[model samples]
Target chain A: MSKVNIALDIMGGDLGPHVLLDAAKKSLEHYSDLHITLCGHSSVYQSFINTLSGDLKARITLEECDEVVSMSDKPTTALRQKKQSSMRRAIDLVEQRKADACVSSGNTGALMAMAYYVLKTLPGISRPALISWLPKAQGKKVLLLDLGASVNCDAEGLFQYAVMGSVFAKLCAGVESPKVALLNVGEEDIKGNTLVKHADQLLRDSQSVDYIGYVEGDQIFAGKADVVVTDGFTGNIALKSSEGIAKLVIDELKRLTTENFTARLLSKLALPFLKKLYQRMNPDQYNGASLIGLRGIVVKSHGNANSEASFYAIKQAYEEAKNAVPDKIKTKIESVLMEH
Target chain B: MSKVNIALDIMGGDLGPHVLLDAAKKSLEHYSDLHITLCGHSSVYQSFINTLSGDLKARITLEECDEVVSMSDKPTTALRQKKQSSMRRAIDLVEQRKADACVSSGNTGALMAMAYYVLKTLPGISRPALISWLPKAQGKKVLLLDLGASVNCDAEGLFQYAVMGSVFAKLCAGVESPKVALLNVGEEDIKGNTLVKHADQLLRDSQSVDYIGYVEGDQIFAGKADVVVTDGFTGNIALKSSEGIAKLVIDELKRLTTENFTARLLSKLALPFLKKLYQRMNPDQYNGASLIGLRGIVVKSHGNANSEASFYAIKQAYEEAKNAVPDKIKTKIESVLMEH
Candidate 1:
């Protein structure tokens, strides 16, 4: 397979250049021909290259972008002010077609704004959605749309989400026929608010995706459906809450093991198995989410993502770019809409 | 403590008389003065009374309701069409001072409609909220407000949630200070939409309850605060989704344990600890949600709640009713808002 060059926002992310530098160095091991454009503080990039003296230095190109988007800054303010931010510069590379795609562990709202402003949306799409993969208890994963992008959505907007999520599931997850479900208050067809019910009917009648019956909030991880569609507000809350609760469960288990000497000894015995089990449920292992339905590929990492996550994020961007995910989604959208 | 009397909607649940009858019989074992008004199919009550001999029959009064509200039935149609439904008759008893409170494991929307229309809201309250007690990883439970009552909420509605949740938390959880937190997309004051931000400002500035700043959705299980206030729509989705995911996790754990010999051995070894862990995390183990700030106390049990859960539901309603929780909530609301 040919190597895919990706623009890495070195100065972006919670841990900054350390994560990006590590991810960049790690990428070379898997893809010898892969070239990385390090868009960040020059000193930060050079110091990472300074650690490796061989062809690694020659393989990495440093592009200085001194200004950075702060996690606390508002998206609009960041867009107006942080013109020279590493994330902004990374999006510019994707826009210029200098790189196949871009990866950033920066401010999500700011990244979306910059991505849309730079790459724009694909044909027939009003706005792009941030589609993330949720680990199901079934050992598989489901693709969720508008994880934090669109808060206020209507029926038409939700229909678009189904199409986008279906395509993402197919191309990324390698699912032949992605089962799409509308996230509702209840499983009954007539249940939920008018918006969700309308969206459910529309998805059912559409040829764009295989519509599963109405699914409730918890069914997202049940593996009954491959793509769960909902408004950004609900999706965001579900995603965060699930993550929170999962962490809570783990913490509980940890607390239980330490409650007594017998339990602590047993916990020590179960360490490997428990670690393996928790690994399967880890969200960071899946990498960053893609800004789908955009003209160019843009992946947004969690701002608090670490080096290990950033490495997976770079691979995510490369995978999407190499798989021609945008073109596949465009084709799917066209084929389905044409029938409509 | 005085034994509390409850109007039990025997025909209102998904499983109908079997679960209700079993639960009612079980509840009577614990509370000798607990009187059960079995409003449902006369046949079901007769069979149940026949099985329970001399002493049990005297404490249980069977009223011929005959009608039932199905899970999928429309709330409005169920109320208007099924006039003789157990749900309606059960709430009617509360309205007529025949019972202290009513318990239902039926259609939630219909139950809410019945409770509001028949029993009415408390004075000075616009709409009553569905308040649920959720067990956090902290070994204690916290109160979640407006699960599905009010949808299009403004600053005032959220403030009212704070007061209702605080009062409910105090009575149910016995929190002295009852630290309240506004559930937002993020913990920052400016993180949420205009409504939440405005509500946060009001909650912080108001002298009503102990506003402990903004809380993210994930912190709910962490027991970060006593009362987590949110708009109905968001709260409903968060609560339902969390329940769903928790069930999904347990289901997955069951599947994993039953996989093979090694897993089965592991499951057996962990059974004692896992059972308690799962029990503590179970939603059914806690009291079903109560419609706080109403003219009378009304508790809604899980639609698919088992015998133990149903018994707890009645016990919860009876206990809260005995405490005159609604009056206390009204008093708290008046004292706070009137001063403001």
Candidate 2:
């Protein structure tokens, strides 16, 4: 592997620079060929730099920016006013070709706005989508996209999402030929609204990708398809609903296990197996969501992510950079658009 | 409670007459004031009638119907062709005031189409919404609506759903002033698409229900509000997605528990507590989604529902009938529309 440069937004997220620095150090240690330019306030970066050893310091660079984008700032406000903010500067590094990719744990709306403005959309792409890898049954992972980027997408936009999502799954997830499906109320073609129905027809008519018919929300984790596409609103709600239910079930299980002596004894005996299952279902393992369809690679981490979760986000950025996902999507989308 | 009559579509559902008869017998025994008119082929009902004796036989009335609505029949096709279908006949009894309510475990689209055609909508209602009880974290349940009835709802349609849903919650769920919310991608006012954003404004301006601000998908199970409303497409996907995730987790847990001797022993000891929890979260307990906004009370049961599930659906119909849900929605909607 050759050296890969990553631009890190240090001033974003709930935990601020401390969590970002910790994740950066860990990621650098794991990948000897990795280099990161930490973009944030000079004083904050300087204090952290003083503690690093010669070898670690040599691999890290500081690109100071005095401004920061707050978690509450609107995406438009951030775009118009926060040009010097660390989030914007990190994305600038990607545009300037100084970094292979940019990673941010900031306000999602602000991060997307800044990335789109700086890197711009790839040819034949209207907007970027938020794509995440979700755990499926049988130890497989399915790629789910439009996780809240464009809320009211038209049929054309959804078709673009399908094309970009297929590219991401094939290049990043290593699925040779991805089977993509549109998320709808039912598996039938006549199920959803006009937008989805039109998109379904477009997908079926085009030979850009291997398009499966409609899939319901429950089929997402059933591992029936390699890629699932939907508007940002539905995808966002579905993702959060799944998480909320998982939390509810786990809490109820814990309460039940602790309420009885027999249950407690059995839980203790089955601790190892339960622990393994819980780890597999943990949300931290799937921390980063790629902002696909951009001219450059960008990954968005959860706002409240801890150091471990932030490291996973960095790993996602590294993987996408390694695979040249943006280039793959650009080439595939052009062919798809030409066919249409 | 006075004597309440329920029209049962015995020929519908995957289990056919067997499950319907079992559930009917169980319901009659539990509610002494209840009477059921079984609508199906006379030969099938006669065979079951020979098995029933005494009070059970006295409470059930068989209304023979020659035709049946298969699960695959489209809504429009069912309405045009299956006039004497068991599902259609059961609804017809409600329209004629021979029964207070109707329950059917047949094709949802078909049932909705027939019910709308026979009973018609309330004075100010344009379309009927599907309302169901969803389990929340604090051992409470929330009323969620438009679960798949009207896929493409306008702003006015969503506002009507809020009004009808609020009435249902107040009457059936027993909430004095239901805190109604519009389901969106984000809780912020600026989030979601044009339809939801317009509906959000209309909800705030209207004094029909206790209009809470926007709520995301996670908040649905968090017990933050009494009533949550969305377009049918989103609501259906969200509901199914939660169910899917729950199934996935339980399957994984079962696999882990059975993999080793220690886990299996522990699971055996914890069986009673686990069983109770499972029963509470069981979808069968939450069957029988009410098709609100119609002039008559109509409940749609899952097609694959067994005897236990069908019993819960019948219980739901009995509750709605006792409360006179249709009259309540009609009166409430009149006042709400006047206010707007």
Candidate 3:
């Protein structure tokens, strides 16, 4: 394997530069042939670099960025004004061929806007989608897309999402002939609105992918489909609601275990199995979400990701870069569009 | 208290007539002031009623219906073709002022359609919404509406949902001046699409109810707002996705506890607390969802609801009937629309 370079937006996310820097350092320790260009304020990098030495320090390069895109900044505002922001500078590195891929734990809207502006869309792809991995039953995982990028999508957009999502699942999750399904309220043909119904028709007609009809919300984690496609609004709510339910269950379990000494004793006895279950279902294990349909690879880390989560984002970037996912999607999408 | 009559669609639901009859018997035992008119094939009821005796049999009335609405029947088909079906006959009881409320564990779309056609919308209300109780963290429950009734809603429709949901929460949940919020992808005002943005503006200006800005999916279970409103598409997905995630956690925990002797022993020790937690979060506990905005009260039980779940649905119908929810919503919606 040759050296792979990644652009890191150190100023993005809720935890800021410290967490990104810590993740970068930890990631470098794991991958010997990896290099990173840290895009942020030069002074912050200067203070951090003083404590590192040798191979770790030699593998990293700091690129100074004057502006910072805050979590609340509007996407249009960030695109127009924050040219020198860490997120934009990092994406620019990918466009300039200085970095293999870019990873950002920033405001999703702004990061998406900057990536699309800098890298442009892949051939025959109108808009990009945010695709993430969700843990499924029986040690399986499924890819869910359009988390919140394009809120209101047409049939064409959803069809395009299915094409991109199928390719991503194949490349990233190692699923061959991925069974793609549209996320809907029910599995019946006549269930959803006009948009989904039309998309369902389009997908069924397309020969570029294996198009299963429709899968409901509960079937998302049942490993019924390798790739699930939906409009941004529905997908985003499903993802967040799933997360919220997971949190609620964990909170309830914690409350139960703390309510009595006998319960505490039982929890202690069950600690090993509980720990394994929690580890398997940990959100950090599935942190990086690919910003697919772009000309270059861009992975978006969760806005509030910790060091371990950020490290997974970097690892994801490396995987996509190695697999040449952007080029693969470009070719696949062009063929799909031509077929339609 | 005067007798509150409930019309039950005995032919509806996956479990069929037996479950409905069982639930009605249990409910009559619990509520002495309750009377039920079961609409279905009278022959089935005749044989079942022979087994019952005394007060239980005396309080029940059986109404014969020749046609039955199958689960797969479309809403339009059910409305146009199945006039004498159990579901329609049950709603007709409400329409003719013979029953104070109606309960159906049938196809939701068909039930909503039949109810809308028979009972008609309340004055000044354009469309009815599907409102249900969702368990919150602090043993609290919030009312979420438009679960799948209206797939596409404009700003005005969402505003009406807020008004209807607020009154329902206040009357049913016993919360005065219920805080109403629109369900969006983010908490910020600028988060969702044009429809939600427009709805947010309309809600803020309305003096009919207490309007909070926006609540995201995670906050739904956090009990941040008394009433959460969204389009039917999003609301249905959120509700189902939450159920899916909850099932995943429970399945995983069960898998873990059964893995070995130690874990199994621990689960036995913790069984009491686990049972209580499970009981608190059971979907059956929140099985009933009210079809609001109609001139008459109609509660739709889960299509697959068991005996206990169906009993809860009956209890919910009894509560709404006792509180005169339909009358209250009619008055409230008329006044709110007048003010607007």
User: Tens-digit lDDT track for model 3 on B1-340?
Assistant: 3999999999999987899899999999999999999999988788888888689888998899999999899999999999989999999999999999999998888998899999999888888999999888877888888898878778999998999999898888789789998888888766898989999999888899899888888888885799999999899999988888888888888888888887787778767877888888887889899999998999999989999999999999999999988888888887877887
For each candidate, the DockQ is: 0.51, 0.77, 0.75
lDDT of each: 0.80, 0.89, 0.89
The TM-scores, one per candidate, come to: 0.92, 0.97, 0.97
If both were scored by DockQ, which would come out higher, candidate 1 or candidate 3? 3
Q: Give candidate 2 regions above 4 Å deviation.
A: A43-53
- Candidate 2 docking classification: medium
TM-score of the second chain of model 2 compared to its true counterpart: 0.97
User: Model 1: which residue pairs collide?
Assistant: none
Question: Which window of ten consecutive residues has the lowest lDDT sum in model 3 chain B?
Answer: B262-271
Q: Superposing all C-alpha atoms, what RMSD in Å does each candidate have to the true structure?
A: 2.7, 1.6, 1.7
Off by over 4 Å in 3: A47-53, B51-53
Superior by lDDT: candidate 1 or candidate 2: 2
lDDT of 1 by residue, B278-327 (tens): 87787777858888777887899988899988988988887787678888
Model 1: residues with Cα > 4 Å off, grouped in runs: A51-58, A201-205, A330-340, B1-3, B14-18, B50-57, B150-155, B201-205, B255-262, B335-340
Candidate 1 residue B61 Cα shift, in angstroms, is 2.0
lDDT, model 3, position A84? 88
